[model samples]
Target: MMRANENARGRLSWKVAHRAIPFALLLLAAAALFHFSVEVGEGDTLAWDQAFLLSLRHADDVALPLGPAWITTAMVNFTSLGGVTVLLFITLTTIGLLLISRRPVEALFLCVALVGGWLSSNTLKLWAARPRPDVVTHLVAVGDASFPSGHAMVSAATYLALAIVACRFLRAPAQKAYVFVIAGSLIGTIGLSRIYLGVHYPTDVLFGWCAGSLWTFGSWLLFRRFLPSQA
Candidate 1:
């Protein structure tokens, strides 16, 4: 029965690979981010970070970004979407909705994920203590360390966590995909706006995105059982 055994082994391998692919990718991404974070912490990326930050500004004047006036204004507006006031309002409104709908468990999960994510973001900034890019003028005011962008991290955690919870109530695959796409687009735009505005280095936003995503995903896994099932 050698042939039969080989067929069974192939089927087992296929099943294992199918189940392992996503986890493998996630693990690799996390490892890469960690390595990059270390490099950043050791000041090994300073040269490239400064070069990249300056590339977005005109060589003649760092204050003038590499775009028209209207684009600068638009970036400012987009940046606010990830600001404290907007995120706070959204978080409160979401919690209210969940409570009213008798989904206390889901509400609690959102609270833990978002609140914990915020604290983690702040902690990372303090730990890294990476200064904001001095190679270019910051279009907006910023007073915190810039290793991990607070706006990017918080926005990714908030939007992605919300999207995950929202997708639970969606019955169709298209609807779920739409929710995810919107969330991802918002996160990407917010992160890019920070860089364009000269308030953060690209690496700061990149690390923020990675850390925020991992935190939210970890929170989801921890609370997935308590979250509502799909419609």
Candidate 2:
């Protein structure tokens, strides 16, 4: 009986440790994001941001980015994926699909996640009010504050939310993994494209990724807890 109790306790402990890992990671990510935001807001990250921007530019021509001419075109194309029109179309299409499938709850949840994330992203950018980099000419036209890349944040939240929704319908583990991998790749590429285009600082992208991910995950957790069937 004592041994049986000990085994049960061991199992409980393992379960707890497994669950704790994600929470720990989430806390760490949040802390890192907050620290970066504060530092960037104080102008502490200016030198770092400038250095990375210059590195991506041509030595003789700060206007022209490094790499072949084709790469610049490619990045502009990729960056568009995170633009307002594209994301709105994707979100509406997904929502329509969900509604057609009789998953209105999940559809609503997706809207909340994406729209709220976008608003939060915009608010943070306004609050940060960090000027766009002048160390290099922007490959793509951009306006407004630049601390947290709106493209990065929106793409991360949109893709991550969509991936979570996709995972629910997917039966195969490999398929679910594929969905998440593709989502992550898209998020990463979109963010990198912004930096490569000289419109966003590396820290801007980094903080955007962190903030967007946390917001989506938090929304997901709430959805799961309150609407388990939909989640």
Candidate 3:
């Protein structure tokens, strides 16, 4: 019987180890992405940033993108996806859905995460104190230190937080997939829009994506540990 129990314990340990592999791999990926992005941000004048930013605009008119007039207008609309008003709206809508689903705890945590993300991103912006891109004219009015695009950071945090909740709580896997796809599109488009409009360099958007994703995943990991079912 003692020998049998030992065998059972060994099997249990192996199962636990297997369960941890995916989590470990995810953390490793996040770390790699974040590290390279921070390095890029530190040296803003690096080749890729300037080349990518300048390539988007017309050779004759720095203010205009290479595309037609309608494309520019469309980009302007897409940029709003990362705007304060839209993020707030998305947050409020998600909070209501969570509440209605009878997951008050999840709803509360979502609220806190978004507010914290907003404050943290803004603080980082002030800390970096990097000026907006001067390679071309800005299509939209902006007056802030622009190391990391605020829209990119804020949208990533808000949308990813919502995606996490949906993935965990929703029954169907398709629902989870849909949520992530929508969130990802918004985040990607907004970040690119900042560069296209000349309000932020590519480095700013990349840094924002890295930081915002790291914060979202870190917070979700903590919450999952403390309240696994709720998270």
Candidate 4:
């Protein structure tokens, strides 16, 4: 039993290191990009993207309402019905799954990741303080500073975290890929929904996605390092 425990510890350490290195690099890259967006790209280019999305958001007579309608509906669902509520639900679900599977450490790690991501997103939002797109009137009321979109950030974190948790039990490469693809699709859909609904500019969504992804991986790395192996 001691030998088995030692072996498990060694494996966990290696796994933690392997997962952490790339995420650390990614965090560095995101920090650089965030700085660039704030220092250089915040004026004309950002304005143009905002205007473009606004045009699409306000296009009522553009002939193909179906695409926009579907996207808008999704945006509404993501913004209102699903949004933060779904994130909380997923967090709780992760906790429940971990408890059921007898992995309390992993469950606690997931909870921290979720809460940490949210806190980080809000902090960045306040720091950036970029305004929202001024396209057709905003479909939904939002007061937070823009730049890194909250919806996009939260959606990315939640879905990507879900994918990570799901991948923990999956052994097949194809299965892992499938999980990532589904998560990616959901994240992409949510980001696009924000743009289509005129609440966020394309850049805002892009930055938010980057930030959220960076944070998710970073959090995973942190958890892997500290999570107990008793379970």
Q: Which candidate should be chosen as best, given TM-score against the real structure? A: 2
Candidate 3, residue 5: CA error in Å?
A: 5.0
TM-score against truth, every candidate = 0.87, 0.87, 0.83, 0.79
lDDT of 2 by residue, 20-57 (tens): 78778888888888887998889898898899889988
Clashes of 3: 0
What tens digits encode model 1's per-residue C-alpha lDDT throughout 1-231?
A: 999999999999998897667567778888998899999989888888889888888899988899789999999999999987888799889989999998887788788768877899899888888888888999999999998998999999888989988987888899999999999999999999999999998899989888888888877766776654643
Candidate 4 lowest-lDDT run of ten: 57-66
CA lDDT, candidate 1, residue 70:
97
Q: What is the lDDT of candidate 2?
A: 0.88
- Residue ranges of candidate 1 with Cα displaced over 4 Å: 1-31
Output the worst ten-in-a-row residue range by lDDT, candidate 2: 222-231
lDDT of 4 by residue, 8-43 (tens): 999999998987688779868877976766752447
Lowest lDDT sum, 10 consecutive residues, model 3, at 222-231
Backbone clashes (count) for model 1: 0
Clashes by residue pair, model 2: none
